[model samples]
Target chain A: MSDDARDEETVTVAHGGGTGRTRDFLEDSVVPRFGGDADGLAVGLDALDDGAVHEVGDRSVVVTTDSHVVSPLSFPGGDIGRLAVSGTVNDLAVMGATEPLSLTCSLVVEEGVSVGLLEDVLDSMQAACEAAGCAVTTGDTKVMGSGDVDGVVINTTGVGVLPQGAHVPDAGLSPGDKLVVSGPVGDHGITLLAEREGFDIEGDLTSDVAPVNDLVAAALDAGTVTAMTDPTRGGLSTALNEMARKADVGALVDETAVPVRDSVAATGELLGIDPFDVANEGTVVFGVDAATADAVVDALRATPLGAEAAVVGEAVTEHTGRVVLDTGFGRRYLSEPEGEQLPRIC
Target chain B: MSDDARDEETVTVAHGGGTGRTRDFLEDSVVPRFGGDADGLAVGLDALDDGAVHEVGDRSVVVTTDSHVVSPLSFPGGDIGRLAVSGTVNDLAVMGATEPLSLTCSLVVEEGVSVGLLEDVLDSMQAACEAAGCAVTTGDTKVMGSGDVDGVVINTTGVGVLPQGAHVPDAGLSPGDKLVVSGPVGDHGITLLAEREGFDIEGDLTSDVAPVNDLVAAALDAGTVTAMTDPTRGGLSTALNEMARKADVGALVDETAVPVRDSVAATGELLGIDPFDVANEGTVVFGVDAATADAVVDALRATPLGAEAAVVGEAVTEHTGRVVLDTGFGRRYLSEPEGEQLPRIC
Candidate 1:
């Protein structure tokens, strides 16, 4: 079978990229396959949240674990160390949790890996943890021979507490819920791409790799947030599609309303890729009840991270499990993304 | 530096195999480094249990996550699927947990990986989970290109509840505490080695890949068990060294008391490897208080999995942080195991 045909049948390497294809593949193939009652489990397969929260008792705790095997350990936007900490902390934040306490880091370092490099990564991780108000309480280091492992792979696990009665679900969408973008999408993916491919770009589109818990708290306090998610791998479109499916609703999106930086657009066009599918390290897609949607948008706009926030879509009871885009001329169906657009770009 | 010197300084690809050199390296290097600090939150690294448990609230939870990457996917003794599930479950079992409730499997599959292979592995994993009485509740699957990934790497994360008031510490060693082994050691490592390297070994030394939680419970119920650990990765010497360090005690083991199968011993002798450091998937090393050690041993011996249980040593305060061997001829020092000692054999 041809590459494209095979890609459709099976997840391609590109699907591993934090791009549209990856997002689509996950929504179409993965989530539905693992059929289960997600009621109190804090499922994010649909919503694209940072981590997940399962209600255990009166207090809900946020739990998230991520493995990082990004090549060129150090990158222009952020290193694997920064990615590990930020990625985990963001998962807690999107769950409307404050102050993540303990973090565990497991390192699989290949023999012949430079001690200097390991120290550098650890230092970066330490700094990131300190900034996020978490401690690296436990860790495991295993050394594999040269061929048995890549240079280094770091798996980080995190735990945070969620407030009572503030439990947010990815399916928090209501009929009039407004969709808000924390900021422009595709910056992190694009930045990493530029570094990996040696692509020169004019603008300073640094990765927006910051903890969004505080920002999430602000939005939650502003009014009722129907849903919250971080558009990491598989980007904004994947997150929206998941929300729609989970809430048993449809989304009507205005393509123009979504924020896209000029540089990001140009880069996407040049690479023949869609920016909507590219992952963002520091971005959130939240759905708010229509009555409080305006206040939510204003609250987001007031924060530095959410200054460019916009109301991109509204939830509709019709077309459940579908997301439609109104592109001025006509309405076009936005299918779930599939496969990797930029493999290993995470 | 010469290859030999380099191997001494850092692990190499050969260390993962079940060769004489692999055993020697582990015996000389790894074990001594993390042998101490068995009490409280600090579990001595030497035990090489699937994971370490920390007391939180009134309960202690066994937390362990293992990344499985075995070549050929399937083998005579066990497949990657069974290994992933059994490995984590055994880790919890060694910690004296009854049933492991939830397990999360993360797959890093390469492009071109067959759907049939994936399904088979999953089926094996499911069966193992059912046998172990656990649920595969959550997971993440990421596909990378052929060159970017090995065929498939499975990482299983498990959490199990430790019975209240049933606390086991690494440092609970007293001079008279008896040492007991769940069963014969080195079968798993040797079997994997023979299969991978096409070694023509005759005797039936199948991988002892069975869960030993029942045996653990029997032993604990019969007596006051000071500490327990599964002899994975670095094997028995590694486990014992960790125990000694934690209890701030020393151990003088009778070399003849340690059980090794005829085939395992013959193979180790032929390969010039120390069987003590070879990995065993199903074995558990328990440090029991003197007064109840015999009862614990008798209870263990009642089970098929623990028929070969033996009291190998006594804890000593004089030789703190050290494991000594009474070879009948004289007293000799026993150091902790090091390096891979048959890396990836698990």
Candidate 2:
């Protein structure tokens, strides 16, 4: 059976992306049924927060979990090991965490996976942990029968130290708030897609997978940033949609203002995929006060990961729960997040 | 090719089991190379601790991550969801945490997974989290292409709050300490094997999947328990061997004293498996002062999950780094954990 036909019969590729069927599944099935709780869970499925915050005495620790099942475990610029660390590190960082402290690494390997390959992955993990300043604290390893799993899948859970008396309100977006993105969009997604599809028109289109905790810290220090999200699986569209819905505000973004690397845009055009619908490994979208938007953008540009940061749009008062995009021409239309075109980007 | 013959060609079923190839891989490949670190990791690959413990301010918080890939999704008595939560919960509990505060559930689903099956798994996860007094805090879901992954794999990471001034040294076993099992063993492993091999056992044999935090709390409250471990992948034999090796002491377990259900023993014999080498989901092995071992066992027996708790062995000053078992026939020999008979039994 063809891929599309088979996907319609069960779970579709969109079910794993940031928007589309993934959000629908969580909202319609998983969230409504199991979101509420009596326990002292500071954050859970209910809020759709990047991480879970648990009260710990006078302070709180933000925790997030992501399964890294990227294909070609090793890729340009980064590997799944690095992606795993960077993914969780960015999650906590976007949640206003200053220090990405400790992490737990869980691994499930298919039988016959070479010992050398596993060690290489471990070396990558060690290096990534060192670079991100996150320690691998606890973990478990399980091997599956050769045919049961493909290669290896690593899931990393990170705990970050949120500064005392500080929280970047995910639901605090308001009219006139500015929207900003860290660096170029679609780099990681396009890179993975190129590798998968064997696109040969590539000149070092490496993934933008790196820890953004330092950038987030700098932005927080510069100004009052309200909703913060790393445009990952669903890219910018999903990130803006979440902020718009939770903050009960509309988002007005300029299509021309969004930063997309030239190579990535060309690749996206060739693959028939929209940049906004793709995934990213190291990127942050933030809503900040209009007054400090420029300063925050400047602060972001000073960082390595956010060097190409730009002020893309502003939260608006109309069209609550929706995002509207303005073309470079005199055209305005509702923004629709495309279905999944990239799977396992992180 | 035959199963055994094929296994020899690649990663055999033994690599996934608690003992045998799994330990060897970690020691030879994982430990010597990637184990040493400059980061102040409290628990890592070196110690082989079930969970990693990190100091969070005045007190400590224990963190653990496990990827549950149990086949059949729905087992006779428990499903993968319960196993996922129970496995990590037990890991934290055996480390001496009375409560597992928060859990993050990450899922990797195949494109062909039915929506109904996914919901059922989520429901089980919700129920298991509620039962374990842990909340599903934050999670990520990814879908792989058809045939990329088998069914679904759930990775759960738990964070537990450690009580003030309470530290359970997992390797600090004294010669005078007695060894105990929280309840009967081999039920989970034997049940899974029976189901996989289509063994039509006469009596009902259900998996003992559960959270043992309450039992650990009771035992810790009752007396001086030096170390605690719940026999999961490696069962009683592996657990004792770990304690013996880490504590640099010998373990003397009485074959008649070790508690094993008659049905489990019979099933193990019939299947050519050793009861001691099999896995147990809800059981814990404790090392306590000889004077307090009975009281600790009594405390354990008071709990519903530990109703069959028994004092089965004691730490010895002789034969460090080894375990000796005394057969009822008046013959004693070294106990060896068998090759993997059942994979994915978590």
- What DockQ does every candidate get? 0.24, 0.50
The candidate scoring highest on lDDT is 2
Q: Which residue pairs in candidate 2 collide?
A: A18-A234
lDDT of 2 by residue, A1-346 (tens): 4545433557878888767677788787678656775445566678888887766777777888999989989888889889988888888888788586677777888988766677668778878777776677667778888778888899999887654546675777999999999888888888888888888395768888988888998899898898898888877777888889899999999889899988889988999877887778888899999999999999999987888899999999998988888887764654546676667777
Q: What digit string (tens of lDDT, one per residue) describes model 1 on residues B172-236? A: 77877888787888887777777777773784657887666677778888898888877776677
Query: What is the CAPRI rating of model 1's predicted complex?
Result: acceptable
| Model 1 chain B poorest ten-residue lDDT run | B30-39
Model 1 captures what fraction of native contacts?
0.11
- Put down candidate 1 lDDT per residue, A24-129, tens digits, no spaces: 5555544554334444555534444555555444445555667777777887667888887787777777777756644556666676765456655776877777
The candidate 1 chain A region of ten consecutive residues with least summed lDDT is A29-38
Chain A of model 2 scored by TM-score: 0.93
Sum up the clashes in candidate 1.
Answer: 22
A127: Cα error in model 2, Å: 1.5
Could you tell me how far off, in angstroms, the CA of residue A302 lies in candidate 1 after the best superposition?
A: 5.2
